[model samples]
Target: MMNSLDISEECNNAFDKILKTRRSIRFFRDEIPPKELIEDIINAGLFAPYAGLAVENKEYFRKFIVIPRNTRAMEKIVEITKNIMKVKSEAFKSEMDKNPYLKKKGAAFSKRLELFADKGVLGIGTAPYYIVIAEKRGFPPVQQQSLAHCLENMWLKATSLNLGFHLVSATAQMAEDEDFSRILGIKSGEYEINGCAIGYPKENPSESSRPETKEVINWIK
Candidate 1:
């Protein structure tokens, strides 16, 4: 049997590998990951930090609604999301046009918006599963932050599972859409929503770079 120090070193090495290897993958194969593995990924998110005090209801504070590809619900959410993005993209363009700084800084973003507005988010249909996460709204409406934490957990879990994951960020703006909210069995604006697409990657992911830990850390007095 391994000693305690050896066990600790082994865990540290495994963690470092996963943290360094995690990268956002866009292109995915049509093949689906096992349902059991997907459930494990969702479970990873469910245990993520939540606003215990800020939650209006403790019981239904968080929900994971998984929609499989090529289904009517998937079709409906994609349509609803596209409609939402189309409106947001137009407004974003108008804002960018009027602001010189914004126009310059958001050029790449504007291109992405154009594609999303026209065809919907890329990974939604390409991946076999579109997972929607909903966090109930509360006093300060800090649900979005909690939703973000949940997604990050799911993202890391997916990376560890050798699954490609894409953030469907546009779904964050779908809160006020009554049609979209109804599909999730929640009233409009009652909950903050976010989504992600997950599947097997078509190709191996390239290495992702980041600043050295020492460079980012602030050893303040």
Candidate 2:
């Protein structure tokens, strides 16, 4: 049995470990973590604070689930996603060229945006597992930002396990593509807002950059 003190100590240790090694791993080993472990991580996300948990009488709340695909299969799916993005990039470039306002953003910005629309998505390359979290908005927008918090927990948890993880919100591009949706069993109008790529880190990684917490925190009494 875990006493209060023991639990607190464990929590602190987990947090320290997480902060130390939670790098956004872009390169992944070929080995995949066990499917059950992946499911366990998603379960951790389900416990995250959301509107559903905030109110006992709320009429609606969102349900979440994760899908675990092997590295090879995920690679194939990513290829399809890349093809769709190429078409989207061409369209975006054409639109930006037509609008003088967009042109003012600078060629580098537009080019990077096009590249993001092209290859910034690392869903399959980084992690052998893909965890997609979605919700039903009842056809109208509702405050669902809480889902992000839930995902953050999963990302951090993966880090604690010495597994690398990063959220790939750019999966939204694939969400809009019909072919991609069909492959993932996603329906229209449903928000597949985010996905996380998770796997073991490579043998040697570049030094990580650590940001000062003060930049993100503002104290108000």
Best by lDDT: 1
Where's the lowest-lDDT run of ten residues in candidate 1? 2-11
lDDT of 2 by residue, 1-221 (tens): 76656667677887776666666776678888887777677777877776543433354454443445554446666677668667777777787789997677757755654676567466545567776676544423432466687787887777767777777776655656665565566674565456778877775354466678889888998
Cα lDDT of model 1 by residue, 1-221, tens digit: 86656667677888778777778777888787999989999999998999888895487789888888898888887788788888888998999989999898998888888888789887666689888899888878788899889998898888889998888887787889998888878788778889898999888776679888899999989
- Full-model lDDT for every candidate: 0.85, 0.65
Q: Clash pairs of candidate 2?
A: none
RMSD of each: 3.1, 4.2
Task: Give TM-scores for every candidate, taking all chains together and pairing residue i with residue i.
Answer: 0.88, 0.74
- Which ranges of candidate 2 are over 4 A from the true structure? 1-7, 53-76, 106-120, 138-144, 204-221
Candidate 1 global lDDT: 0.85
How many clashing pairs per prediction, in order? 0, 0
